[model samples]
Target: MTLDEDDRQRRLPAGRKAQLAAYVAETGQVTVSALAERFGVSIDTIRRDLDQLSADGVLVRTYGGAVSQSTLSRVDRAVDVRLKMEEREKEKIAVLAASLVEDGSIVMINGGTTTLAVARNLRNHRDLTVVTNSLLVPPALSPSAVRDVYVFGGAVRTLTLATIGPVSFRASGGSELDISCDLALIGVGAVSTAAGYTTSNLAEAAMMREMISRAARVAILADSSKFGRRLFAQVSELGGADYLVTDSTPPPDLLEALAENEVELITPDTREGAPEADQDPQ
Candidate 1:
């Protein structure tokens, strides 16, 4: 009644084997329908593949699919884990932020997971100059056919992999950017009607505030989690932002506050094709 070696090997499921191979080829992220169609299996079978891969630490299970361990490894997981937790929502905000950028325009981007999404979506754009303090941004735009990137110099903050401190702020302040940027896409640790955008570190908050001051259009890219939360230092009052790009819907109170501040609220699907509104004619 003993099973032979070949019999034992045969017990290993074909579906699992195919999923592993697909994951290896695609570097772990694949749509469930694509995997199912590729293997002529059910959607449930692909889901099982994703579960096993996640258990093995070979990939991270995302909302619709799985992303490779290597892709997740690029950023420190402490930050990335929190980011990946809301992939679709962030990307939605990113898409809206990207639309704000014009070709051949100069822009300053802040450091955060949501800002990283904006960098990714900007790949197809051309002749754009980007000034950023985030270490993660340059690599995102590096493979693009067009794009000029400048990474601001300063003391590196390990937690977020962003450059902070006086040097970074000074460099940003000294630059005579064209139009001082068409927009500055920023990410905040927290946002409240009373406190505006805030961050945990005082120095970092100062740098962000300086960037906001210098930009022509100030767009804050925040998700629902940022709303209503307060942090250590204030970047600016909500009045500073010209627009706030977020996911589909935000909390009612926060929405009311944003409207009161006269901040333009943008969502990905609704605003993707919309033109940039006229900036305050101050």
Candidate 2:
């Protein structure tokens, strides 16, 4: 038997709970009964442990059991590679997301290959102010459409081309104030029904949360593949976003979860043009 399987044979309620974490990582997912059987614990005890693990971010609780928070591994890919990973899907999501931005709006966008696509799609938008932490986005935007491009200063990630730092800082004139935006276009590493929105970097998650707080409305640009997967740091719950702009429909459970959080899922329609908000997203 493997280490996790051996841990299952040992009966220590408190310690077993911790070992359950190992089992989760080893097995990826497990039912409550399975945990109880593996750990030789009571069903109620296993349930409590699952609850704790979920709270601790060690696992994502499902209806039946729990899954490892790292259900999907986050491999650091170069910007060029990421752009080619889900090119068409990113284009669809970007087009739909760009349509949500109106002219003369101040928009806040974070880093990612997907959000860069959205920046490209927003090329023709006039009198718009763009604030961002991505090194690659500003060049993708059109000069005529932009009033200004406010690039956030921070340490840049070479792999993903995103900056990690404080979302709010004192102005050059030494005035302290928070920058608010009409909308926030954020792209995250992974998303799940239970764990909500998450990313690989903790600093990015914190910065994204602060960015979300300052936005009047939030739009999360993620492809369908991101659904049901989670990364290392928790960004926010599903309710954190006002809209989820994705390439395809979410699964049934995820759809219900997004609905529960009042997040409007916006997926591309079968048409050749922009999709409307009234249509079903999932």
Candidate 3:
């Protein structure tokens, strides 16, 4: 180590284990050498601390050092299983997402449990034009005051109970008109600052992108667990959407990334300065 670093280490405070955990949480992921130098300690000491933190479920151990448990990457689950997980958080996100839709606006919804809840939350909206590929979504809004519900015709994927195919429709005697919507609410499989938005299925990702293309405003509905996770197919890059609706604030790095993308983050605790979307959802 450098002589200055050695001197600095000697002056650092004790109670390193707790400090180490907090450090990991703040930075998201850290490497052994970097942490050691930052804390003015040996690499071996940092490794030991990381191991103990991993065992305690305080952090997730990685190849070089450790990643914060809160931002550790994850994967998609079965549709039914996903429906049961994070029910309340999803509902809150759904409610917030629904706030982005105006009463008479045409809105496009991508398929997912959270997006399904978003559809249900729109029950009070009237004269709404809805377009979607989700088989389940149409039924959710059937009893609502929605004026027209257009289900995209495509190959049905039983796993997600959604359709996957072309984004356009064909009529025997005529070509289709250009489609547009005011808002597009999408639920993704995984979301990370590095990978942006993604889903496990390629076709699903493509459909989501197409839906976003046809909308004037885009809101991504995801619970906090979806943060920092990446999947096989990318849907859009960071800043690709207008807003991110979640149950809680994202990690610092992710929060900054979303801000950089101009993606307004909306959570129960973060609605302070946000537009009263329901009042002027233009």
Superposing all C-alpha atoms, what RMSD in Å does each candidate have to the true structure? 9.7, 14.0, 13.2
- The estimated TM-scores of all candidates read 0.66, 0.70, 0.69
Scanning candidate 3 in windows of ten residues, the lowest lDDT window is 273-282
Q: Candidate 2 versus the native: TM-score? A: 0.70
C-alpha lDDT of candidate 3 relative to the true structure:
0.82
- The digit string of per-residue lDDT tens for model 1 on 189-229 reads 77887788887778778888878877889998888767888
Which ten residues in a row are the worst by lDDT in model 1?
Answer: 273-282
Model 1 error, position 87 (Å)? 1.0
Q: Model 1 reaches what TM-score against the true structure?
A: 0.66
The alpha-carbon lDDT assigned to residue 165 of candidate 2 equals 86
With a 3 Å backbone cut-off (N, CA, C), the pairs that clash in candidate 3 are none
Q: Which regions of candidate 1 deviate over 4 angstroms?
A: 1-77, 142-147, 167-179, 272-282
For residues 38-78, what per-residue lDDT tens digits would candidate 3 score against the true structure? 77779998888888887787887766777776664435444
Where is model 2 more than 4 Å wrong at Cα? 1-74, 270-282
